[model samples]
Target: MEFPSRDLELATRQATLESDTPQIVGPQVVLGQGGFADDDAPENALVAVRDQSQWYVADSLHQARELAGKVQGRRSSLEPRPPLELPEGDWALTLRTCWVEPAYLETDASWCNPQDEPADPVANGGAFGGKIASDVTDVARELAQANDRVVRVLWSREDTVRHGPKRPPVSVGLRADGSGIFRLARTDHIDERIRPLLPKCEIEQVTIPGPPTSSAIRGAGWAEVEMLRAGLSGQAGWVTAPSGASAKATIANELISVEVRAGSPLDWVMFRSYCIGAAHMAYSWVTSEGLSVDQNGDVHDLTIRSFGVLRSSDTPEI
Candidate 1:
């Protein structure tokens, strides 16, 4: 993401996709267990402070673990209210990036529809771009209207993984001559993301039936586009955003060096952190990050623990 103002934003992303695997989205890394995430899933903090002041958002049990990441400083444990009881198969996705908890709920209007009121649970931006069209608020509104009570819609990690959309997977074929075409799911124009950085590439569309998918997650389609290009050209390439933010990532020495630039940085901490995070994710996606699916399109690994995310010990250096 880039800005016309003095704000520099950068991110990196990469994920492995098998040429033969079906274009299906399933619980690969995050093998969900009882509630949200698997009981064995490790703990990670979105808001970590050096002073040890704690604010835990989603927990092991409540971990939707899709993209709702962020925590804060000390405060009374304000456990949010429970969502209205909706029957089975009643939830929706991608209505708009929404969180299970509503920060504000004092609506003057009673039993209103979506147009009368709109809520934004996310304070900053969408969660890693993964929550592009999350639908928590819509569910809350429906439950509140139907049950005549304040409702909170919390999706367990299982609900998120099983129901939430994922970054669409891509299939590409490269020739030794540094020229080839890449195939994507329905309506994905790989050239749109790759053209600025990589000049010439052909795009082929295929109808690979699969789960909910999107191209907006973090690096969106940029990282994979470059990875495909580098794999064929055997050289380094840059990443460009429609907003004009750009970064040069070299694919050599099995080590990566990225140089990012934003027109002007409004917030260094936010911009740089996301940039670094994006870089790490992109690197991992290029090197690892894949899923195993069966003939029926079921994901075998449900926990991120099983994901190919490189450990700190496994990574070399920035």
Candidate 2:
């Protein structure tokens, strides 16, 4: 499934605009779902505005503006709450939650173990395989809390990006004999944010250590590690197998608007060339060895080339 990059971009833009004005002009409508599996589910539509010197949720933009007007009319209630402080050093946010239900059993066959079944058909898995999970709900709750004045507001893009859950970078080690026979494979992934959100599987993770910056992103440490393992495995050999494998990823907040325009083309072309070269080499290796299938249907000297592409669309606007 695709990531919600467009929605996030729009929301970030709205947040920036709202932060600029001193008085609450209108409700700021930030769009995006917070929880896991929210892609197939309804997206959370948040409208935040000032109310009596504190932030409050307005169901709609109009309602938010009305509340802001009322707050302006009043001289003052309690002093305005202090702005939330951003964390120092790089940080990222992550959110997650989980739910489970039982279903009936139609037919049963077991490996020497017996079990009872529910009466109704169980729709057990996620909408899109394992894509949907608790992370969505966790993020939703965090956003709601921030909007409701339970937590301090996130005021800037730098704060949001640095303090949010970052996509963990990964490294893989692969070994093969001189003839390209697969051997040992090892994968490593590090979530620099993990230390702060200790013991909380469903967490409002932040790379920066502190209280005010407690919002969540989509997947946390486990997801990053699992994805890295799968990705490295696929890179090593899965994509070339008779039964091919594929992957889809959505990266958020990696670059500023300025950097995206400046860096995308060079990155894209280099990656594309790498993929083409790798595919060609793998194919050539497989064909040249003539060690195709014997009577036993076995082949030798198979070389799996690890390479990939991050291509740009032909349309420059893309």
What does candidate 1 score on TM? 0.56
What lDDT does the true structure give each of the candidates?
A: 0.42, 0.25
- Which runs in model 2 stand beyond 4 Å of their true positions? 1-55, 62-165, 171-236, 239-311, 314-318
Residue 49 error for model 1, in Å? 31
Q: For every candidate structure, what is the RMSD over all alpha carbons to the true structure, in angstroms?
A: 16.9, 23.6
| Clash count list over all predictions | 20, 21
What does candidate 1's lDDT look like per residue over 242-310, in tens digits?
656778866467666778866654454445665566667666655555544333444444444444566
lDDT per residue (tens digit) for residues 43-134 in model 2: 23444333323444455545655756632121112221111132222223311111100110111100100121111111221111121121
**What is the lDDT for 313 in model 1?**
66
How big is the positional error of residue 24 in model 2, measured in Å on the Cα after superposition? 39
